[model samples]
Target: MPVGRTRPAAAVFLANLVVASGLAHPAATASPYLLALAVLAYLLGLRADRAGPALVLFGACAALDLALCAVLGVGAVHWFYALSLIPAALLLPWLAGRYRQARLALVHEGWERARSLEERQRSVAEQARLRERTRIASDMHDSLGHELSLIALRAGALELSPTLTGQDRADLAVLRAAVSDAVGHLRDTIGVLREDTEGEEPTAPAVEPVEELVARTRESGVTVHLRREGPARALPPLVDRGAYRVVQESLTNAIKHAPGSTVDVGIVRRADRTEIRVTNSAPPSGSPPAGPPPAAGRAPGHRGLTGLRERVLLIGGTLHAAPREGGFEVLATLPDQVNPERVRSTGEPREESGSPASRRLAVARSGARRRFVAAFAAPVGFGLVALVSCAYLAHQLTGCVLRPADFAAARVGQDRAEVARLLPEQQFRYVPDAVRALPVPAGTVCAYYRSNGNLLDRVDVYRLCYAGSRLAAKDVLPG
Candidate 1:
């Protein structure tokens, strides 16, 4: 037997010993031989095949009976009759084993199902977390980056005003320099926010015209030259955005690291693909690069080539950034079919895709809607159904288990005097004491009773208040 079965078998053996001893002392008058038979039967019940052991026990008991009673052939007939118990004992282990196996199977199945459900819930939660992070990062890039860029642009223009006095010029230059630094800091922050650690779908900016994008780069003090060879065709949103960002970042880097260098920005469109190239000479000695100035709030390498490479690859594009003839060069090629509708709908200057802020907002909204729907719908529906089913089952169970007599007694008044008069002999002492112990008012009677039995049995009674021959109130005794 298994270790877990030992305790139950031992308990059954002890209980059977006590029962056999009690039966032997009573009408059975079983002898030592009969006691031996009983012990064998008890042991057999704990093992696999009880029928054989039970038959042996019956034969032993019959022989003892015959030997004591001095009867002829009577013991054999009695033993045959006693053998019927063998089949009943044989069924005990089978029934118990089946029941135990079924219960264990049910428990195992429930545990497996619960584990599966938990895993599914965890997967969904993880997806939701990723979506929320993406949305937040996109929002930060779009809103903050745009505002800082505008500040830097305005400051640059103010410094260029020719009518300013010496002090005014110096102050304007300082302010412009500060603003440029702040813009660089903002770019770094946006770059960090836009990092897609989860490998989520890329949230590229909407496509804009190549010329207009070049104009924006020029405003930021980066010299740009656009060269195109073929009929212009609308590229996919991802392709356009990827191409735009590659050129944008490349020019930004050129301005920041190679001041006074004439950067060549070129866009080539063919029948099936588009290519972009940007190259600028290294900055002049002792002159700060024209890119956004360093600032405390910006991330390191904000305008580095790494962000540009990521943008290019996100849209199925290829990028190459390296030193060429004492200057840096970035080359990229993008496919022509990414997503045309998303590109056209934004309607920003065909060349001037707004800041990353706008692109991030659109992606965040899309992801949030999808995440919210998936998060709550299925589990909440299952829980509501389970709750309703449980309530219905509880109602049915209550109806099935409640006793009709008790229910009726609650609705009707009880007669305490009748209850006391019908009390059984065994219950007479306790029933009267119980009734007298009740703090009932004078002329009112109270008694205790059972819910069901003959009148002699303790039928349920109640505290009865009668006023002028009419029943005033009744309170039934609690079970």
Candidate 2:
């Protein structure tokens, strides 16, 4: 396995070895070589994705150390001092490493979240741009298609007039057919832009009145009756365009669906609103459809009424189209003044606050923040416990060491009672193996003490032996 992948296992193995060796010889825990190895093991554990076997191994070692020490009849203070090494050497470094790993993960997740959000925003902007382009194309198609129909109607009328020569009539027929072909091409271009999909189209502005539109249809051999009830007044551009479109579209539908029908158009301009109503009577019996059939490549389904409804609603108006008295009827009410600001505001696209992607990202960020807090809190808490324990162990261990001056003051043949006051309250439990193996005089009981109280530094040990209630010999042992 790669080094990075094997780090956790190495940490567990090395940490267990260090801890086990320290328990066998308590003084080894203080050696720089062993302490450095323990620190390295903890640093390796930081790479583990979860808490690994190191902690369990440490607990097992601690229990075994205490049990072995108990069987050997070691002092309670020595056992407690030995137990404190577990947290200071193993648990503290591991906790700190885990915290460092968590901090790095939090930062990485933040950058990823920002990148994902930016991508989603870019996608949304692209979609909105496409939709706007499609709407503009639809609007152009509606406006131009209506005007072309009017031109074709005029050409047909000229072709029927008796005053025209035979050559003139043939030219007029050609002109009308060309106009029909132009309309078909326009439809095909819009269909290609929209991929055969229908979209809401807005009406183009026109200064023509409903009366002029009706008169033009009448001249084209269609029976159209126009009635204007309200006083003549200059209307807003949107309302004027809407009124013209309502009559034009209704007439086109009557001509195509019910030929030879009598169409009635009523325009009533009130103080607050303009009302337009167009109704066509049922077709005469045996009357064929008036307009030419749809051309090749033209998409099916009529989109005129749908476009009209969208345009009317855009200007804060209402439009209704339904069948009445065996014919079609269209009723529209347009307000005199529409709020341009409101219309523009509605047209502009906005980011949706409740979108699923947005919600999911928010939740992920929240979770990352919580984990970061927890990672920091756990290490700090573990560190505090370790510090308190280490401090207590240090205090107890300091009491067990004999100062160099005290060792120097003792005499080899001094009375035991006088020398007793120079001795410390406890004996050093971490005596070196060399000192323990030294030859002792016959019938002498030997006790070991560290030369100094400093916990981290390697120092000499003093061995004092007593024989027959008198100090027989005292010597310094290297550590």
TM-scores of the candidates in the order shown: 0.42, 0.55
Report the C-alpha lDDT of model 1 over 4-36, residue by residue, as the tens digit. Answer: 255434343343343334332312433344343
Model 2 regions more than 4 Å off? 1-5, 26-46, 51-85, 88-133, 157-171, 195-281, 284-289, 295-326, 329-367, 383-479
Give the winner by lDDT.
2
Error of 1 at 44 (Å): 19
For candidate 1, the lDDT comes to 0.51
Tens-digit lDDT track of model 2 for 337-416: 97775455323344455876556556656655665575567667767876897797677668778877888899988998
